[model samples]
Target: MFNMSGLDLMVIFKLAGIGLGTTLINQLLKKTDAGEWVFYTTTMGIIFGLLIVLQYVLQFFEAVQTMFTF
Candidate 1:
């Protein structure tokens, strides 16, 4: 029993978008020789994406607990 609601789809899309944007920005920074910023950009993107997924993971655990009355 998996939940695949619109909100979940949106979250997945958001993560993908963040990954793509981060890659593009990193490439641009590398081209301009701003190598230091590329790392920070990627780290921030990953952190933000993790936070988003973490919220859903918490919600999923809550749902499971409620379903099984654990």
Candidate 2:
């Protein structure tokens, strides 16, 4: 029951966008001498990305549990 949808592509794009955004901001902050903020920004980015995938991961596990339960 693997049905791919437009949302899957969007999620991938969103993750890619976050990665690019973080890299650019990291470089900009490094150049501007705002090194202290870099850690927070990168951590936030990782958190956001994880959040974006958490739902799907949970759903996948739930589906597996249900499939095997019955």
Candidate 3:
């Protein structure tokens, strides 16, 4: 059996929402011939997503450290 926390679920949802929003915006930008802005928007989305995940990764490392007591 595996245990999943609310934080994990939230992280997944947050990433998914970012991805969906980015895709939608990208499509809209393309349609409107604003291709130049698409790169910035996509980059911002990826950076934001990575920042969210980075917090969890740090927490995971701390937990592992405490578990091993080293």
lDDT of 1 by residue, 1-70 (tens): 3365746568878999999999999999999999989889999999999998888788788778889984
Q: Which ten residues in a row have the lowest lDDT in candidate 1?
A: 1-10
TM-score of each: 0.80, 0.84, 0.83
- Candidate 3, residue 59: the lDDT equals 80
lDDT tens string, model 3, 5-69?
74757778999999999999999999999999999999999999999888877887877778889
| Residue 42 miss distance in model 1 (angstroms) | 0.8
The pairs that clash in candidate 2 are none
Report lDDT (CA) for all predictions.
0.87, 0.86, 0.86
lDDT of candidate 2 over 1-70, digit per residue (tens)? 3234635688999999999999999999999999999999999999999998887777778768878995
Rate residue 49 of model 2 by lDDT.
Answer: 99
On lDDT, the leading prediction is: 1
